[model samples]
Target: MDIFTGPKLRDFKNSPPHLQFNKYVLTGYRPISTYRDCLQSLFYLHNEFGNIYTHGIPFICFLLVLPLSIPWAEIEWWIGVVHYLACLSPTICSVFYHLFMNHEGGAPIYDTLLCFDMFGVCLVNTLGALPIVHITLLCYPSSRLVATLAYLLLSGYGVHCAVSAQSNVHRLQSFAWQAIFRFFLFMLRLTGAGRGSPASLRLYLTMDTLALLGGLVNISRLPERFSPGRFDYWFNSHQIMHIMVVLSIVYLHWGTLEDLTWLKGYHCPGE
Candidate 1:
C-alpha cells in the first residue's frame, strides 16, 4: 500500500503537527493566545520594554478601589461605583494603548490612543478628587468654600495637564510635570495657606514641599538616565514615579477619610 494514498497518511498530513503528535497538548495559536506569549516574553528583551508598567496601572487601580468597597455608612454605594469606574478607566485605556499602539505602521494611531490614555488619567483623577472633596465639604460646612475652590482649581489643573501631556511625546515626562503640579497643591494644603494662617501654613507647606521634592527626585530618573539599562527591570525612574503616585493617592484618600470622620463628629450647620 502506497503511503500517499493511505487514509491514515492523509489524515496525519491534514492534522496540525502538535495535535498529530499529542492531542492532549494545548498549543495557543489564536490571537488571544498572545497574552500568554506576552507573559513569557517578559523575561526576554524586546520592544516591549515598558509594557509591564503600562499594563500594571489598571491592576493597581483595582486594588486601590477594592478597599473603598468596605462598609462605610456615610459613603453611598453609588459613589463607590463611580470612584471604582473612574479609577479603572485610566488603567484600561493604558493597557489597550500599550498592547496595540506598537503595531506596525500605527504611529499616528498610537499617538491618538496614547492621548486618550492620558486624558483618561486626567479625567479619572479629577473625578476621583471631586467626589472626595464634595463629600468632605458636606461633612465640614466651614471648609465648603475652601474645598470647592480647591476642587475647581485641581480640576482645571488636571485639564491643563491632560492637554500638555497630549502635546508631549514623552509620556513619563508629562507625568512628572503633572506630579509637580499636584505637589504644589499638596504644599498649599500642608501650609494652611488656604485658610489664611501664615505661620501654620508655612510649616505645613514645608512638609508638603519635602514630600513633593522626594516624589520629583524619584520621578526624574536622574541616576538611571545617566546609565542606560542599569536600572531597567528594577528601580527605574518610571517605577519610582508609579510608586510615588500610589503613595500620593493613598495620602489623599486618607486625608479625605480623616476629614469625613472629623465632619461626622460635628453638626452640619444646624444639625
Candidate 2:
C-alpha cells in the first residue's frame, strides 16, 4: 500500500485486543503495523490521528520555542534545564506512544510505551516543581533541603505507581501525594509563610485543575460515552485529555516564568 494512501483501517472490535480499551471508538483502528507503516499512519485519518498530533505538534513547538524564552544565563543552571525538560517530556513521550502504539511488536510494546508515557508525566511532576520548592523555601535553607528531599522521595513513589497503574483512576491517584505536597506549598504562598510570586500561585493551581479534569474526563470517557462512534475520529476523551495536558504544561511554564522573574529581584529579609 502507498504510505500516503495508507492501509485499510479496522474497527475497534477487529483491532488488537490490547487496543480495545475504548469501546465507544467503534471504527478507524489501524492494523498491526511496521515502524514505517506506523509513521505513515500519521498522514492518514484514523482514531489515533488526533491523539498523535495533539501532542506531536505541541512537542515540536515546545522543542523549538521554549528555550528561547527561558532565562538560562540569569538563573541557576539546574533550574532552567530541568524546567525545559519538564515542559518537553510529557508531550514528546505521548507523541511516540500514540504514534507507535500499533506496532507489530504488539501488546508488550504497547505496555512499554504506556509506561514510557507515564514516566514522562512523572518527570514533569517531579522536575517541574523543584524550582517552586527552591523559591518557596528561599529564606530557610534547612527547610528547603528537607522539603526538596521529601518531595523527591514522594515523587519516586508516584512514578512507580503511575507506571504500574492498571487503570486511569489508579494512574490519577498515583499523583495525589504530589498534588497534596504542592497544595501545601501553595498554601504557604497564599498565607505569606513561604516565598514566590503572588501571581504564580494562581497559575499553578489552574495547571493542576486542568490536569485533574483531563484525567477525570479520560476515565469517564465523556462525549464519546454520550455518543459512541460519533467521536471515533476526533474530540474523543483521549484527544481532549491530550489537549488539556498540553494546556496544563503551558500554565506550568507560565507559572514557573512568573516565579523565576520574581526570584531575580526578591531576597530574604536578612539576605
Candidate 3:
C-alpha cells in the first residue's frame, strides 16, 4: 500500500505492539525537521547527530588542498592560513555549543559559550574576504590604503559579532546579512571599479549594510513565524538564508578570479 494512502494509516494502527514499538523507537531517534530543532537535538543520540559531525570533513579537506594547488606568492600563504583558521573556528565552537548549551545550571558558562559561537561566525565572515582583498591590493598597488582599512573594519566587525551578547538567532541573521552584502560589493569590483577607489569602496560599504539588514530579516522569520511548522522542511526562511550565503561566497570567488585575470595582463611588481 502507498504510504500516504488511508490504508497505510489503518494498517499502522492495527500493527502488533512489538513491531510498532520497534518502528517508533527507530523513528524517534531520527533528526528533527527544523533548523532550530536540529540544534536542540544534538544533545541527544540520533542518526542526524553523526551526520552533522561528518558534514565538516569536506570543508576541512578543501582547506588542506588549497595550499597545495596555489603557490604562496600567488595568493600569500599566510593569508590562507588565517582564512583556514577562521573557517575552523566557527565549526569548532558550534560543536561545543550544541554539546553543552543545554545545561541550565551553568548560566555564566552558557553565556560565554554563546560569545565564542558569535566569534566563530565573525571570524569566518571576515576571513572569507582576506584572500580576495590581498590579491586585489597586490594587483593594484594604489589601493593598498583603502584595502587595509577595509580589512581592518571587516576584521573588527568579525570580532565584535563574535563577542557580542546577542542571541543565536540574531547572530545567525547577522552572518547571513553580512555575507549577502559582501556579494554585491564584490560584483561592483568585478565590473571594473578601481581597487580602493572611493566609488568602489562606497559600493562595498553599502553592500555590507544591506547584508546586515537581510540577516536580521531572515533570522527573525517575521512572516513565517506567524504560522509555525508550515515551512519546516522546505521553502523556509533559514533555507533562503543559506542559499544567500552560498551565493555570496561564489560571488567573492568570482571577484578574486577577475582580479587574477587582471593581474595576468599586467607585469608583476619588478618585471
What clash pairs does model 3 have? Answer: 118-162, 119-162, 177-211, 181-207
Query: Where does candidate 1 have its weakest 10-residue lDDT segment?
Result: 24-33
Model 1, residue 156: what's the lDDT? 68
In angstroms, what RMSD does candidate 2 have relative to the true structure? 0.7
Candidate 2: lDDT of 20? 91
lDDT of every predicted structure (CA atoms) = 0.48, 0.94, 0.48
Winning model by lDDT: 2
Clashes of each: 3, 0, 4
**Predicted candidate 2 versus true structure: per-residue lDDT over 156-239, tens digit per residue:** 999999999998899999999999999999999999999999999999999999999999999999889999999999999999
Better of 1 and 3 by TM-score: 1
Question: 124, model 1: CA deviation in Å?
Answer: 4.2
Clashes of 2: 0
User: Which of 2 and 3 is ahead in lDDT?
Assistant: 2
Question: After superposing candidate 2, which stretches have Cα over 4 Å from the reference?
Answer: none
TM-score of 1: 0.56
